[model samples]
Target chain A: MGQNYLASLSHYVPELLACLTMFGLILIEATYKEEEKGRGFFFLSAYLGLGSVMTFSFFSLSKPAVTIFTNSLVIDPFSSIMKVIMVLGTLLAVYITSQSKDIEGNLKPEFVIMATGVLVGGMLLSSANNMLVLFIGIETLSILSYVLASLRKGDDRSSEAGLKYSLYGGISSGIMLFGMSHIFGVLGTINFTEMAAALKGVETAQLAILMPSFLLFLVGLGYKIACVPFHMWAPDVYEGSPLPVTAFFSIVPKVAGLAALIRISHNFFAVEGALNIGWVGVLSIIGALTMTVGNVSAIGQRSVKRMLAYSSISHAGMMLMGVLVISELGTRSVIFYSLTYLFMTMAAFMVVSFVNDKYGNDHFERFNGLIFRYPLMSIALAVVMFSLAGIPPFSGFVAKFHIFTALLTKKYYVLAIIAGLNSVVALYYYLKIVRLMVLKDAESKDTIGGFNILNQSVVVALTVPVVLLGVFWEKLLLMADGAKIFIQ
Target chain B: MISLSSYLFISFTLFIAGIAVMIARKNIIAMMLGIELILNSAALNFAAYSRFVNNNLEGHLMSLFIIVIAAAEAAVGLAIVIRFFQIKETIHIDDAAQLQS
Candidate 1:
């Protein structure tokens, strides 16, 4: 028994280390004098701690999938890959925040702690095997995000954003819990595997209750991912939060929410004719609607941040196409798209954050004559924007290509068509930004300025992956393919 | 003894009321109360289901967890409400539309 306990503890070493590091940060913040803490110490320590945790988790690749804590959490390739993505995402976010002028001085430690808290929650979410664990993981992530969204004290917009996010979050999760009560009542089990097993014997009449329950459950997941009809809070939250937090919201939770959705879908919805509630049809309609709403709404936005928020929503819709297929290829494409998306979205947000830092806002007009002044940054932004528009020779195109191919392979022709049209609509807005940056003459030539080395490096670091992944995507595709083993 | 269906009906009523309150109320604190009502209804459903459907204790345990999570959510929600009030001097959500496009 003691040896078994030790073995279980060993399985969680990475998470334990991350938690300890977070506690250490809190302690250092509490104990140290404001003058003695220095400028970069918190961020540096956060980067080291998160980076080390991410690097260490890579070793779990060689280990077999294990269910610890009485099957509440499963450590597998899928969870490990997602954990890496989330940790790396947080690490980059920390680096970006460190470089940004928006969050300074006393707020730095709190930012690190809250972001790390979200990362830990995301990590747990990816590994969750039971509903109870999933609930805790999501709450931990959501609560911290609510706080992070409001971190800019004295900013009315930031506080309002936090309030809106929490209000939506609370209502959705409450509804989801009500749905969970029904699911538990029907199956008498919270474990996904057990729920799947029980679902095989469910009667058609029972599906009446089950179908609505599942739809209600989707509400919580949909809110986290910010799909249409459930995405009202996203633009407000994204536009109001600090840039790094907005960037964090764009990537980490979406990925983690998708991870959780994929896990739940695989366990409950994947079996043929086992529990026919017409989920694919439902998901397809949701996918089409999400992309259309996101693209159309994005077009009229003047604020660059709000436009990107809608763009991210549309991207989530495209990724949903991959999820709808429910096959190995589908999951593989989704994972690949998510990985590529990380770089492109981060690069775009990094540029936005830098511009926001410099000009004190993220207005499209602010980008005029950018190429004439900051040529390198403009070129980087142009590349990132083209990639986002799904143009060829960039990572975004490859990601979208995988998703469309997955839909075609599954004979989801209508969805493919809808997605294709949405891409066109998306291109117009994306290019509008590019045109402003490249062709529109600056109101004044001296407005744009060169970026600092750290900011430039971050942009370059994110851009190289977008370019390289377009050319050398096979390796990452292979890794994504490998990650699908856990789902199967 | 009360049947499971009656408990479910009562809980469903509470859930609908909660959602209605959430939609109709402009005050942030009232919205939070609506959320709490919804959560309590879920907890009630879980407890009822645990007694009627399952022979084990998982449903009861889940309700307990939900209660704890709801408490945490309320704490955060109240804190955000206070912050919003500080910034805008009113708890009406309509007054806090500074970030809208």
Candidate 2:
């Protein structure tokens, strides 16, 4: 009984932390006053943030990760770095929530609870060595996100968005689980590294199952990344979700989900150019389509929220550029780029949320004279926009440069050219939003006016990195290169 | 003893039944139930293949994991469904087509 209890306790700490924090939050919600609920929520989010930081540090420096959970999960430098990303993104999101007068006024603790659950799940996913654990992590994140997405209750559109998320998520998980079963049937193993070796020994005729299995796995993962053909659910969900939650949805999950995708492909399916050119080709094509479609579709949307939704889709495509190569350099590029993307995205959405709060709307016309009125906020949004558009002196340009260099090193010249051209095309649309805020002036005045402190901090927080990346990128570049060593 | 084909056949029927219900059911609850059925069938496959193959711990452990995830999904999914019904007061998916283009 002692041994059994120890085993469960060791492996389940993160999940248990998730459960405890959630329980504490529920208790707090009932006992705390309405105006003070956001404070309690922030405290809970900070607790999870501390838990993540500790786990990451332990995974990096100690042998604790090695002995945890009977070796079901591995905690390594890669997982540690990704954990920090998840933690930062989640903490900022909770901060954004805590500061919102709208949300805190009648707040529910479930917001904090769900955010922590998603963060814990994402951190676990980064280091999931077993396929089953991967599924668990993914579903936990998705389940919590579904609630977060629909949290602005009593709105018909919001509920509809939640329903869409469930159906898409449910189907994707079902497919992924089926694929796992097939993989077990073929290789007789669920561990990713072991399964790779087992599948290698199978005869050519027998490996036919490999294609279907991989296809299903890709679809399951693809939905999370919001790649084209699987991105049917993103726009509605983004538009309907409350602003901070949408911001969280757009940035954090993509990082963890794609990190898992890269892990599966790297660990389970060894990249042999001689054998797996097909997977590379499939990924490259999808990457190309995702970027082009996301960029083009974004241009046509009148609603700023919906436009950002499409922009997020395209960024997924941009991130996949690194995944197609799947080298140490590629992985490092992905990590660095995702880190850069996270802050820039948060910054951009911070401005958007602030604007939405002040103007009481999300239409493009309302954004006119935004720069004239809210200079600091507009500048922050511009910084993110320029960075996203791959303008120099910003980290987005540096991130894309690393990917292009990696692809070139891999001799993927055509893909390199396509990404380059796409960035140029992407520039136009991102600039359109920038244009509305500066080039055109608003026809009508906003009722609730003035720069809110929370948004001011959000913009300041967001702008620091983009400008720093533009100036002192080499420091992070070196760290990225060092991290690349572990990815292989 | 159940033959390998019979076990596979049972899995197939469950999979097919889930697909049918997902396509035909009008109520969101019924559709989600179909999804649960499909996930169970898939989990059974993990167990079945594990038994038939090398009788190793990998397959069984995987099946256990699948069961855990399926339950998590169901709980959250049901919660969402309840939340949706509270707003719309209807369970039929067709009536909830605000997002269809």
Candidate 3:
């Protein structure tokens, strides 16, 4: 038994390293004097730790999938790739936090600490193989996030954001647990493999009970991903939270939730049954509504940050389409979408964070005539916006092409058409910023202090991938295609 | 007199009452209680199902974890609520309308 446990531990290295980093950061923070700013060593070690975690996950991409900790958690190529994306997102968010003036100096370390903790949770969630691990993972991701959302301590808006997040998180997770308990009772197991095997022989009456329960299960995850019904908290939270925290929220949790959603759909509903039809039908409606609502809502927003929040909701809808397809191609496309999304979102948020810092608000008017002042940064923002709108010659287009290919392969024409229309709507709003940047008159000649040499280079570096990935996406798609879900 | 159905009925009632409380209550503290009620209902269901139907430790374990996580969740929820109260001087849900755009 001990030897078997040792074997499992070997597959658990990346997660353990992440946990170590979180604790190490906490301890390291204590040694600093109370008034010290720019905890230089703290951030350096954080980058190194997250970089190593990403390295470990990248190396594990080729290893055969395995169930560790007694079938509670999985270590598979798909999960490993998700981990790499999440760690990169965290690393970049930490960098943004280090540079952005929106968060006070004293609170910056706490941001990294909470972010690392959240990263650990995201890691667990992407690889969860059973209900228990999944619940634990979601809770860990959520509880810390509530704190992160309100990291601005005394600000009423930040406090309100945290309150709303916890209230919503608490309710949805409760509903999810209720559903999971019923599932455990009906299926006689919490392990996904055992549950899937049991699902093969369930009675229609059991199916009746299971259907509602599965919807309840989706509440928690849908809340995490900020889908249509559960997305009410997202805009408020994203707008109210500090910019770096908002950037973190947009990437890590969403990707982790999508990864988990993909795994769950592939595992339980992949086989043909009445349940399959019901699940697909429900997801299709949800995906389409999510896209429409997100895009339509975004068009009316005045704040760029809030608009980006809605845009992310729509993006989540697109990824949900990939999930409902439940094929290798669909999974591959979602992985690629998330990878490109990470860079596009980081670049956009970096620019917005800087602009918000300089002007104290990120309204649409703030980006006016940005091209006249900082041509490189303005062009980068424009490229990212175009990429986000899914225009060709950008990675977003390539990613969307893959999803469309997967959707058409499965002959989901209705969803395909709706998605195409949503892209058109998305383009209008995305181009609003681009238009303001390039065509509108300058509001002020005051240089944005956040656009120093180092930050400018970093923003440009992030945007480089956004433009290059559109042209050279074949290599990344090959990497993403290797991320196959392993069903036991 | 006591069977699985009775236990399920009670837990389901708790679940509904919890949702009702969440929807009906205006006080932040009361709403948190509602959340607790929902969590406890699920935990009770797990325990009862473990005893009456599945006859395994998994349900029992799930219930225990639920209890623990619920406490942790409540702790964080109340902390945020306290912070909100500190800022706005009110725990009313209606007052958190600053980001309504």
Best TM-score among the predictions, by candidate number = 3
TM-scores, one per candidate: 0.96, 0.91, 0.98
- Report clash pairs, candidate 3: none
Model 2, docking class: medium
The residue pairs found clashing in candidate 1 are: none
Determine the backbone clash count of candidate 1: 0
Q: Per-residue lDDT tens digits of candidate 2, residues A129-216?
A: 8887888888878988898888877778887888889988897788778777887788777777677677667776657777777777
Residue A139 in model 3: lDDT: 99
lDDT per residue for candidate 1 within A1-488, as digits (tens), equals 67776778888877887898899889867876767746566667777888789877888865778988777788887788888888878888887787777776678788889989998888888889988999888998999999999999888888888988999999999998999989999999998889989998899788889998998988988888898879999998998888888988999999988889888888888877734338787788887888999999999998888888889999999988888888777887887788888898888888887788878888999899888988888999999999999999998899899898899997888899999999999999999989998889986665433277767887888899999999889887676555445563
Q: Distance (Å) between predicted and true CA of A144, model 1?
A: 0.6
Q: Where does model 3 exceed 4 Å of error?
A: A480-488
- Measured with C-alpha atoms, the lDDT of residue A39 in candidate 3 is 92
What TM-score does each prediction get for chain A alone?
A: 0.96, 0.91, 0.98
Instruction: List the lowest-lDDT window of 10 residues for candidate 1 chain A.
Output: A479-488
Please give the ranking of all candidate structures by lDDT, highest first, separated by commas: 3, 1, 2
**Better lDDT candidate (1, 3):** 3
Lowest summed lDDT window (length 10), candidate 3 chain A = A479-488
